[model samples]
Target chain A: MKNSFSAMARREAAAGYLLVAPAILLFLLIGLFTVLFSIGLSFYHLGQGSLITSAKFAGLDNFQNFLFGRDLNLSRAFKQALVNNLWVLLSTLVVIPIALAIAVMLQRISKGIRLYRTVFLLPMVTSSVAIYYVWQGIYEPEGTLNKLLAAIGLDSLIAVNGWLGELHTALPALIVTVIWGSVPGMMILYFAGLQTVDPHLYEAAEMDGAGAWQKIYRITWPILRPITVICLIMGMNGALQIFDPVWIMTKGGPANATEVVNVLVYQQAFVNGDMGVANAMGWSIFVLTFVLSLISLRILRDKSE
Target chain B: MRGKHKWSPVWMLVLTMAVILTACGGNNGDSSTGSSDVKLTMWHWKVAFDPGFKAVADAFKAKTGITVVTQAFTPDDAYRQKLTGAASAGDMPDLYAYWAGPLEGAFDGKALEMGPELEKDAEWKNGFLPSALQGVTVSQANLDTWAADEKSSDWKKERKVGQIYGVPLDVGAFYTIYGNAKLLKEAGLEAKAPATIEDWIDTMNKVKEKSDVPGLVFSAKTFTLYENWFMNFVDYMKNGEESFTNFMNHDEKLSDPNHIHAIKIIEDLAKSGNILPGSVSLDIDPADQAFAQGKATYDIGGTFTYASLVAMGMNPDDIISFRVPAYADSKVPDAKVTPFPLVQMVVTQGGKHQKEALEFVKYLTSEEGQILYANGAFDLPAVKINDTSKLNGSLQAMAGSLSSESNWWSENSAISGKIGQPEWQTFHADMQKVILGNMTAAEAAEDFDKAAAAEKAKAQK
Candidate 1:
């Protein structure tokens, strides 16, 4: 009976691996393989042919040219895009704390609160293209923003050819759109995290003569740490891969004021047909995002424990 | 603990290996597995030209019993991206069409050159105009590996230099300056083409002053418009073609005083408020809309712009095509327009059905196939048009220029595509600065020169 039971346990374990095998293989094939392949490709100069025929080895050169080329052409472009990407991330991060506060406020209010939350989440459901176009209309020269400025007799504030076209405002305009689009969903995460928090903590803080600000500082923030970290990770990844709104609206134009890293990498891979440079860019972006992710984790470390 | 324990650190190493293994396995696609099949696949970016292709495809199928599958990718950029990826994958269609430049050049040696057979067949050889045929022909330089002294044996084993890899599908012009007669009439000025740069400016300023309209309008947001404009102005300088040729040969600096001065003319016009306000942000469609709404007297456009303007509700008679006016102190006595090929078809050697694909190309280039294309798409097929009276006004206008005007060479495209000219992009960027008062034209020119030198150095390495 003991021998039979051991055999059955082995069989069950084998079956478990069998079930997970396809998932592992597919993940390796599609996700992991592509990442590793890009890293290998980054070391060579490949275009116009497959790897067996065309690619020539030049290890670390592609990376060097893009990051620290003499002309400051590719490097400058990469740096500029990094700045733009960081702007998107930082601007989006600013919204999370504000969103958490809003979620907390909504949680305390018990009457018809679902309706407010639903309205707030409406933009999250709408397509990004549609939302961007709406924003584009708002920011156009004759658009609502300019009209509002004109109405308020502050006509000088109106940007020439709309805000998206101006170098000074193009990235900032995109950041605003991204933050608005991201807030509702992030707010929901915070709101859900708020629910999981023990209500007694807030009550205890109140009993200890804690004001609203003190309750948030002492009780609310501590519990929401994990959720904030998750949001930051997500926001960083999203910012790094931002392509849609910029492409749809700017095409990285008005002198490339909105040329982010992803767009440049895309241009290299497809438009310029320089896959090596593109792969180098991909790895560089990965390193950046990985560093950012690590920083987020460090920020969210359980310091008290 | 259970989750963390299950995901061992060793699994990370396994995953990394999986990535490398997968990439190595997935990347090297089946190379040139041209199977014996009567089915022909053709790829193009013109969805509007579907009926034209279908008519030709149907005729070919009826004649040869070969099935032709056609796929169309719109917005051209998507089409190029697919073609580029497919080339790496060895999955390019049996036959594909592209504008003759970096795109068609990408498949230069990979394509079956039709030089010998095409030269022997008088009917096929004589069907296309010289310029039309020239657009699709692959020059020696375009075949980067092909040396001037290379023997026929060295030339793809069966082909030599000066061979044509593609045949033209249609012809069109770029950078056609459209004069709005309606707007000009409103300004109480005669609607006609100006002969000199001063005259053009005078006419534009008169319209701007006399009417509530800008003198000119363009989708200046993109680099293509500026690049084309820059070329036109450069063509007006002393030894215009020689200068252009020298520039293409990489001997002439992009920041030459003459080139910078030429660009300055356009910059000055914009700085003087001749171009529409916020023109830098306006795309082609919006600029066309503004012109159609009578907001501008002159707009830079292409062959399709006429149809677009008409479609936008302008009368055919009100629209007229003229080459951009030239500099008075220029070497060229008369400025002429240049009409280039719109599309060309080529059969890839990478695929199996080469003979069948060639037959279809032959059919498409035949008189009947050409007629079907012209009638259906309202486009001028590459064939010699004995009678263009029945053609649409826009097409007829383009065809009329074919006899008198020069044909723009594919040289610049080849050179620029090959060299990765960073200076052109820099020049394009600096024009914005020039107009915005951030830099003078001279400063932009100096930067352009520096950028060119930098690019040259980079390329040499």
Candidate 2:
């Protein structure tokens, strides 16, 4: 095989390998190694302050503990977190359309489009921890949201315990924050997609007596269906792995109403120091996320192909 | 041309490997032990205590000609994460601070056993409060409990029953009630902590009546103070120590009338509109800030709270500290607050400078060092200070609150180990609801009892 290649070809091949070597090595060392290590860690019981070398082989016990109710508290927390993740995923139905609507409006605007876009993108650009703190203030008992509601004579609707403090309202309050943070990125994606849509389609829709709503329903939506699918996938992945906002805002508290898989994984790993179980929970969430993403892709796939 | 560039791939691989190795490797920063330049690193999560630690470290270096480097990580949870990462990497500092109780087990294999050294040096050993040492010591009850618990295999194996692993940095309790003297005087009440639970509430009511400020404030969102310390203290006052033990051991239920009464006391206080508004949303620092800013008439905290309150700009002269007051007609009316070690300084097994680290630990708990720390940080010391004038006014007040009483639930070795169980999560959540008036105290107590039963069953399995 070496003799089959010319000297010049061999030289080019060597150069190519050299150019990509760092990236390949980095991917193997940091990315693949950690994934493989955590997967292996799931099969072992490693307590805190003990090295990985001292880990005892536990077979499937770690997974069974949470998944099979061997540990009731862990199982209940895991199931509740799984349900919360699903709720977050379900919010994409509302999130994508709102983002698309904003994008459409931005596309139609003749002035200050940049300013509107920048204003809308501010949350995306700002530090998420800072934004969570800001939102925490807004949802506080004496926060702006409750005060605004009271000012408008809707005093009965106030959450006296604060939005994140009430069990009934915590998850929804979190979901709203999640949607607000997520809308900006999806809006930017949709805006880019809308830019590629030819202006003549709107003109054609108008000639056919299609109103603005009908124009969007019949033309814009169909053309942007692929973007919608992409947004749904991104949203699903983001929601499933969402940790920082929940951690900063509620800490999966008010009776674990805002608990998600990542928060549970964090608690198991760092708080409880049950590395094996934490890794098991992490891999389990990964499997669920993969399956959900794949199913959504299959369902959203165009049959015309 | 190919031959000229042949070493490029090999060179790049070497450089990347070197970079990764360099980044992954941690240096303990220890040199020859006898050398004057030998430095030992210590880590802790006490934000307000950083300056005090620095002053002590500087004094130690001047006395011994050895460097003691100190690093402070804040907010507690982040420091736990840091320790977890360091432990996994086998790169823990020479000395670090850790919590006692269930959390001490996590550092079993890593922390150096200082028992033999303490036993040998009677002068140094006797310098610390006896209760402080008892709190850090691994008792027979700890051994039995760890052996029985399915999750405590590492703890049972690595930690011996009759040995101590760390030195107490401070002895404190979270059940202390602090009153703002300014607010008390403004309400026309005595500028002192109320004598009993009823008295406290009555004082709070007076403050509310005289001014817009609430009667009481605490880190309600954190819930540990309300659900654990305050609840347990009230339980002891109302039902006695044996009843408290029975409830923890599952021989008695939280739904019992006495326990429900304890829960109802907290509920009644909340119902009285004495708790600060939006308290359910505030954690420790924010609640402290609210108290310091005079938004509340009184705050509930521990020995550590005095320093934190003073640091937050509250005048020490304007604050009165006392134990979480007992109930009127209480079973143990004369119950005094006994101090228990909260944070412990541990020498890491992986450190190169073990002797120097041990010496640093000794100096940190020495009388002179305690005075420097207590006066500088306005924090309580584990070691008793005969010279009360050496401590700040707030620190002295905190010190005066401690006694030799050992009949409380906190002092019970068997019950303390069970206090951190998972059932408390349900209890804490319910306690929040009880404060918010969404659930009756009896209902909350029933839920806690059910949760505890479920936990007990799981533990049995």
Candidate 3:
């Protein structure tokens, strides 16, 4: 192997390594090291504001507190947060079809396709904090949603406490915001995939006496399956790690109705200063997310095949 | 071509390395120009107080020939992160301000013990009110609570009482309420303090009936505000010191009818329909802004709320302020609000300019410094000043409200430490449920007792 490279080749390889050295060093120090450190920290009982070197090893105690019922309140909060995360994940069912429908509609239109795409992608590119605030205003007790409901003679349907302020509506309101932010990238993916399908294939389907729905189902659906998988994976990850929306809008208020795992992790780590338990809960979320992603991937791949 | 490529790669590597090295290089030159000259760095999270702090620092520099550099960090949680990060890097400033609360336990061993120094200057020590001193001073109760903590290290367990780690710049009473004078007059109500909770409720209802705006508003979205800040005052007022102390110490359960009634009084206020709509979602600043904007007639906040209300363009003369009204026909009917230290200034344990930093701390807490800070920042001072007329517009009113005779719970004290965080969080959420009319106050009280019991049981284990 050494003999295979001439002096010039060896020198070129050295230069390449040297060129990438700083980046590799940074990744190791900032990214990979912190992750490994958090994993190690999950098993300890570290007091607040103490140095990491002073952390006391507590074995599985940290995990047991939040995962099992060693600390009942913590365990209950974690369970509630997990359930909220599932609700967020389940929202993708509504999100995917709407996004796919928009992609299909955008494809049929001949004019202003780029303008439509850019408009659809605005939420994805916008600052999430600013968007959360806008949604917060919309979800206020006298906000646009309630006012619209009132105007439509559905005044009985308005939430008096605001959408983000009630137990029944907070989670759903957050899910709506999540879906609104999530759909654009997914729609763009479907749109790009739709662009690849030959127009002649659709023409052939039309000549075969297929209706619009049938053509969409037979020709368009199968081609978009891979993109659907990607969307599902991304959506699942995003929902599980959802923080900014919940933090800004609700802060998991009105008695933990909208509490999600990441928000709980933040409370435990920064607010409560229970770093060990926070890290344990974080790892637990990672494991759950990994398993869920893997299952979804396998099922989707099997269907695709 | 091969020869050119070889040297090009070599030269490029050298250039990149030089740039990287230059960027990462530390300044090896000495920062201190003179051996006798002293410069101290202080950090705080108060953005409004930054200019005042700079002015005070300038005064200190002129008087003592010591340079005090003040920096402001905003939005408390981020400031905590900054302090912790700087601590980890061993690059924390000479002095920094921190909130005096259960959270202060984090800085236990990290802050320099100022008890001996404070003792040396009896005047400075006595200048701050006894209530203001409670936050910085570690009482036996504090030591006992720390000892009982499962995570307590040897230093914490061995710590004694009378250990002062910091000095407060100002004292705050969280149970203070402010009324919009224009709205009050419009409602045909007198612009005076309500003597009882019932009177306050009646006044709010009158305001609601007569005016377009709602009568009452607060940061109800802050889950801790109702239970921790407001209800504690109600409990102390209704049940008196004995019952409040027992409940705080976890010896008495919140499920008792006495505590339940306190919760019921707050629930009644909510049930009156005079609370601003969407208040359950409004945060602290927005609620104050609501009162300032004449969207609401009344607001519940602390001494800190005045500056923000004024900043929002509310006229100081048009504002009527008072403590949270006492419960009528209850124990301690004459109960008044007590002011406890809101923020503490401390010397870092490993600071380079310890002596100068201590001198600055003394100056900052001095009578002259308090007047300078209070007037400049539009804030209340910790020290008792004889000439209240010298203070700024609304601060004089706030300073007058601080009485030496009033007794109240201090969140920064050990009493708060005894209530476990999990229990406080549980009670906070459940109390919100009660206020929302989703659950009865009795039911919430029962839940709170259970949560406290569970916490105690876990602590025992």
Candidate 4:
């Protein structure tokens, strides 16, 4: 019996190893290769040569250029992108909370919950490029938004055609579009998290003479903490990596007011043919994201404890 | 129990070994080249060139019997991004199209040389426009020349200022401007185009007052529109010398009286409310659509706009092409307009079939090919083979008028830097600022000078 037990344990162990082997191999092949290759390529000043034969190692020159060089416009672009992303992050924070409130209200209502959820979730499912185009049309001078504004007698107060062109309004314009597109998904997540809250705890709180606000503050909020953390981290990461909307709608224009790090990196790698600098920018973004994620995790942990 | 434990370890060891072996085998298999068939892939952004490319590919296949695949990308910018990504991945197309600008110079060394191919056909050199040929050529010697003079270094220097790098596909003369002739006639204006800046503005003002049509439809978002307009103004102001040289060599500032005067003119037009209300947000297509619908009386655009206007359902004869006026008192002789040519096909270094590619490029520049591009697409041939009879109705007359003149220049000739071409875009944006009343004409000029100087400094390094 002892021998059989030992044999069974050993077989299970072998099966576990076998099952995980392919995944490990894939991680090494695809993930490790790209990580190493990008790092290796970052060291070289590559132009006018094949990757294998022509790339000449310049040690930390590319990194230095990206950080402190004068010829490359990368540092300025990076700063601009970071600023733009900060706006996106702030907008997300504001929009997500509002969306969650709406979702919670709808969750308590039994009659139109399905219709409400579907309507709220529609923006999330729509294509980003299509949304950008629609938003662009809305923002145009004679577009729907301007016409509506005029119909309501606010035409003289605003410049209809230059919303995206204006320095003060360009980033805000993009932020509004982004918030409108992303709020639905976060709202849905909040709804799912709210559904998981224990009804018994609310019942007990009510017996203890707790009010609606008190129940929400003590029990519901605590239960939704993890979901909020997930949303915050994901939202920050997504905002940091924003490219498609800015690229399609603005091209970081109106005098580079809407320029972001990802867009700058793209222009460097592809438009400007400065791959070394682009890779450096990529690694910089990676480090930034890592630091941010760590900070977020620490905050979440502290709050939970 | 001892026997079972020992057997279990052996089984575990065997599984680990098998996994490691499989991984190693997979890695090895993946790296090996597949089947012997030599496949050559080419990528281009020219959708209009699809039929032409197909014909060439067929001809090449018939001659050498190699399977050549061509992919055409619409909306050129997106295609460029994809091609750039492919190049970074070391999976660039075997053949691709590239523009000759400071922007393209960033990838110059990576591009394949066609020096050997050019050596094979001397007649291939004769078919291109002298100016067009001068636009693409870059040489180490030319680089040395620019490097030799410290004083001249700050001036815009081309990558290869005078070398022919690519075959000239098409050349456009900047003389043409599309106007609502019916509106012009209603304004009590003659059928003839404006001869000077004063006449042009007067005509526009008249049209604005008399007709329901707006005076002009120009998109503020389009860099090309701003460039074409600004270049025509600058060209007439400076006569024929390159604007950069005038600024750099003669201490001529962008804030010079002539340039500021030009900005004021464009701004005045904007303030007149003669432009469409939301022209700032309108892109090239919708702006052109507005023009096509006769919402405006004038659209200062490319020679290709003539074709586009006709295609948009306007009578081709009703559309008359005119030269954009220079200064108020500027004579018609001094108002000679220069057009900018879009860069076409380039042969890359990674091209496996350079011989065939060169043959294909050569055929494209041939008289037969020129005639085909000209007749089929209404494109102006790069070579000055004055055969307007083959062209469409009104275009033939335009071509006839073009033959009566000499010394036409391309706006691209004004670009001096190998990587600082975005300054042109910036210049246009500054012009927008001036028009929007965000800045004065003097301020716009100063800003332009500063921006141009900064770009020049960046490119010099």
Candidate 5:
């Protein structure tokens, strides 16, 4: 009876493998294969047109070219890109905490809570590019921001060139836009986390003579820590990959003030026609993003412990 | 645990593969249509040329039993991406418009060498403006040599060079100071045609001092018309025709004391308060519109932007263009800022319909054909056509300056093709700093010179 049962189980396993084979094959051929191929192309010197006909075995030269200054001035461009990315990453750290605070505030409101939640979540659903362009219009020389400043007798604060045009303000202006767009999704995440939190703990803290701030510190944070970690991870990932605001607003102009690594990779691939270096840059970016994300996760884990 | 089974769905992986495949799907090709008759396909980004191309196809069909199919894609980069992919697959449209630069050079034997045939026919050759032919002209060196491997001995031959890649579509000065004819008249500036740099400055300053409207304006945000044309003016000020030839030969940097002088000239113009207040922030369209709506008196523009001015409801007669005049302390006294090659049409070697394709190109560049094309497209012709009576104000301005304006760097200049624009962008960034009062002219020159030298080294590599 045992032997017969084992034989039947083996047959079922074979059937299952057969059923999933097509999906596995498709993924290997198109999705994972493309990524693997791109990684391989990073080591080859693929010049401008007709990639197959023109490429040569370049080894680590492409990677070296991007990171170190070879014959080309790509290193400077990359440096600018890294600087901008740091700005985004640092800005997102601040943004996630603010989002959490807002979510906590929303939790306290009893009447018309749904309306406030809906209003807060509106930015998450709106198109990012549309929001960016709207911000652009507001940042123009004769745009709404300047007009408002002028009306308030704070006209001296308006940038000589528009906000997006000036080197000093372009990245800061972009950071504001990204934070504005990102806050809502994070609010929703915290809100969901807040619901899952055990209400008994907060009541227990209250009975122990815990104040509102003390209750939040003792009960609210410890329970919602996982959500905070998730938000930080996603926030950091999103910030590092910022392209649209800079592309639409400045084109990395006014002297490469707002150029991020992603934009650099794109320009190298498309504009500069150096796909080999572009791929190398892409791999580096992926590695950097992974390491940073892992570090964040580790730190959060340690802090909780 | 004698037997176990675990099979969760790879749903995310499947979905990702599907998206990637969708994005990598092939472009919809314009395959040959007519049966029996000799069939051909032509591609371009000039959608305006559709009517003219159709008429020419009809005419060609009447003359010989052949069918010509044409397609146009726009916003340029999309068209280029498509062409690049097509070239990789060894599928090229029989005839297509391409820019004359390193991109064209990359397709070595892919394109048919029309130069030998073009040179053999004198009547055909003379009909073309020398500058037009020179615009698309480059060295005969095969691009297989330029492949990253860098092996060329098999096809290499000494003492033979200068190949014309394709026939130019049109040519003229790329950058000009276009006056609002009405505004200039109203401002009472005696600057109908600027004879010198001082005269141009005086005219702009007069408009600044007298006119109720804004003064000199140009798009300075991107390293495009403003920086490029400024460099052209500077280069002209720096190099004579021979010295510029030497500059193209990679002997001279386009930055020096003379170039710094050029920067200061523009800086002085800005300091004069003759420039529009927020000109540094505006894009090309808004800058052109500002001048057109009587917001500014004089604006710098190219062939394309000049058309935008007219399109924005500015009268044709109200728009007048003049060359960037030679400055007082210049070596190239007769220098005028000239146009780079715009676009070229080539017949690829692998296409089955080569004869028919060449015939179409020949017809399209002929006097009659050029006239029809000019009328259809609202631009000048590559060939020296007799009539300019039908051309618009912008084209007329472009055509009128053709005789005096010299194309400073021919397309043959490997320096310009390899790293000119990239290096120029760095220079432009410094130029911006100089203009914004962040950097001095001397400091800008030093930084710009370093960048240019690095680029020149890259190009040599």
Candidate 6:
């Protein structure tokens, strides 16, 4: 009997191992290989002839170059990218809250709420490339926006070109696009969070003579804190890693006004072919993201606890 | 505790075995097991070149029975990223198309020397124009007219500093300008194109005043429009000296009066309501579309625009070319109108199949291949072919007119060295500012000088 029981347990264990084996193998093959190889490559000088045939060890030289190199202005680019990322982050924080409020209001309404949601989320469902093209038309000097300004009798203020050309306005213009693109997702998250809030708490607050603003501030906010934090962190991370929109729309143009860190890293790696420096930059971005996420999580955890 | 204990050793054993398996599988499949045949994999971004290139590959295969695989990348930018990544990862294709200039600097010492077959191909050697050869040759040795003694001659005096590293596939000329004849007729102007910048401006103003169409359209989303304008304006303003000299020689000062004047002209074009409003938001494709749809009178573009316009269903006859004229009052005697090359292809040094690759390259640059490209793929042939009867009507006209011009240049040629220069970008932005009435031309010029000086200082280090 004991021998039979032990045989059964062993068979079950073998079956479990077999089930997970593919996943483990795939993870190691795709994810770990690049990570380990990149870590190894970080220590070597990868130039033209030496790319395949030879590798010379130069410990931390790549990192040193990233931090302070003569040949590459990585440090300056990184600083500028970080500043651009921060702009995106701050803008998202401001915009998402307002979008969430609008979403919550629309959710409460019985009529035309579906229409509102559909219209609000229309930009999200549309392809980014298409959206950028449409915006491009609207932003043209004699395009709809300028025409509107002229109609309003602000002809002197009618700068026909989009905000992309001006260094001062380019980042802000991109931020508006990012905010417009991201709000729908955030709004949906907030709506889901609102649905989970107990009706009794709101009723109790209302019974206590709490106004709409007061009730929201006192009851709804505390309950939605977790979702808000998630939204905030994800939004910031997304904004930090913004590459496609900036790449397609502006290409970090008008003098690197829209140059985020990812754009810089991409240019360094692909455009410039400075892989070693690029890898270092990638690692730096990874570290920055990890640290930022951790800090955000810690603050959230503390508040929740 | 019991479950955890059971899982620990199992996980360890599984991980170890997986590692071993991965190590075994990590071998790249490039190593030939027993096959003596050499297989070359070539990647290119040109979809149009595929059929012609495939024919050459087929011929090579018939001769050697060594398979040549050709892969085309969609969307050139994505292909470049992939190629760069592959190059860095030591897994690049055997032969691939690459751009010259700053892109060439990326793979500096890493390109293959062509074999005897290519060097001995007399037809290929004699077919290419002198300027086309200059664009491809990177080394002094490969040049037709190098200094007699390398040691005695000044480095600057050397005819060429690098070998002919790439096959001259196409002549990327910039003199081609596309204007909508329909728009011109609507504006009550004759089909005759403007001869000078002043006349061009006058015609544009008249068009704007008389018609509903925008005067001109260009993408202000990036510096492409600004750069293109600057390229032409620099030629006119400096009588074709300041910007080109500054770019070629690192030691030359960038903040010359001519460059500043060029910036002023671009700014004036923007400020004077000549350029389409909201151009900063428009990109190349949309801008081209605007021109094709008769929304704009002129598009300052290249030979590729002809193909694009035809693809958009516009009649080729309606799209006419005009040469941008010299400055109305210029001191330089030999100033000629020129435009920049759009693209150039090079082979990287890290490639394995150098000999076979060079053979393939030689085939691409041959007169037969160029003619094929010109006929089927819409490429402006690099070589001046004897037979002009087979050429497209517009191209034939362009070819006829091109010989009379004295200057030939690429757009990026002026600021080539200052590609990554931050001040160069600032210069572009300042030009925009000047056009917006935020700064004067002189202020813009001073700013450019300061930026150029800073860039020069950085380069010196």
By TM-score, the best candidate is 3
Question: For each candidate, how many residue pairs have backbone atoms clashing (under 3 Å)?
Answer: 3, 0, 0, 9, 0, 18
Q: How well does model 2 score by local distance difference test? A: 0.81
- How do the residues A124-238 of candidate 1 rate in per-residue lDDT, one tens digit apiece? 9999898888998887778898899999999899986688767788788878888888888789999998998888987888888999998877777887887888888888888
Q: What is the DockQ score of candidate 5, to 2 decimals?
A: 0.22
Give model 2's docking category.
acceptable
TM-score of each: 0.88, 0.88, 0.89, 0.81, 0.86, 0.76
lDDT of 3: 0.80
DockQ for all models, in order? 0.15, 0.25, 0.33, 0.11, 0.22, 0.15
- Expressed as tens digits, the lDDT of each residue in B159-216 for candidate 1 is 4446777787887666478888988887898888887768988888888788757788
> What tens-digit string does per-residue lDDT give for candidate 2 at B295-404?
89888887777778888998988988777787786888666767888788888875898888888889889998988876766568989788988888767866886784
Model 4 TM-score relative to the real fold? 0.81
Interface RMSD value for candidate 5, one decimal? 4.0
Interface DockQ of candidate 3: 0.33
Find the 10 residues in a row with the least total lDDT in model 3 chain A.
A46-55
Q: What's model 3's TM-score?
A: 0.89
- Tens digits of lDDT, candidate 3, B1-461: 67655657788899999989754542212223312257899999998887778877877766766788888888877898888778667778999988864226235466788889888999999888778887667777777776676655555556677777788888887777899998888778899999888898888888887875777888877866765556776777788777888888667888787777656665676677777766777898988888899988888888788888988999988798887787786787766666888888888876788777888888889888888887877767888887888887678867776774424554335664444468878877776676677888778888878878888888888
Candidate 5 lDDT tens digits, A1-305 = 99999999999999999999999999999999999989988987765554455566788888787687874567788877887898898887888888888888898889999899888988888887888789989988788998999999997899766787677887898889888888998888888888887889888888899999998877778877788888888888887877887887777766777889888888777776777888999898888888998988887883636
Report the Cα lDDT for residue A36, model 4.
92
Interface RMSD of each: 6.1, 3.1, 2.3, 7.5, 4.0, 8.2
TM-score of 6: 0.76
Clashing residue pairs, candidate 5?
A: none
Model 6, position A12: C-alpha lDDT score: 100
Q: Write the per-residue lDDT of candidate 6 for residues B97-139, one digit (tens) a residue.
A: 7654322423334555432344677777777665555555544
Model 2 CA RMSD to the hidden true structure, in angstroms: 8.2
Candidate 4 on A30-131: residue-level lDDT in tens? 999989988877787654212334455768877776577553344545676778877887886787787789778877999978898888888988887899
lDDT by candidate, in order shown = 0.73, 0.81, 0.80, 0.65, 0.72, 0.64
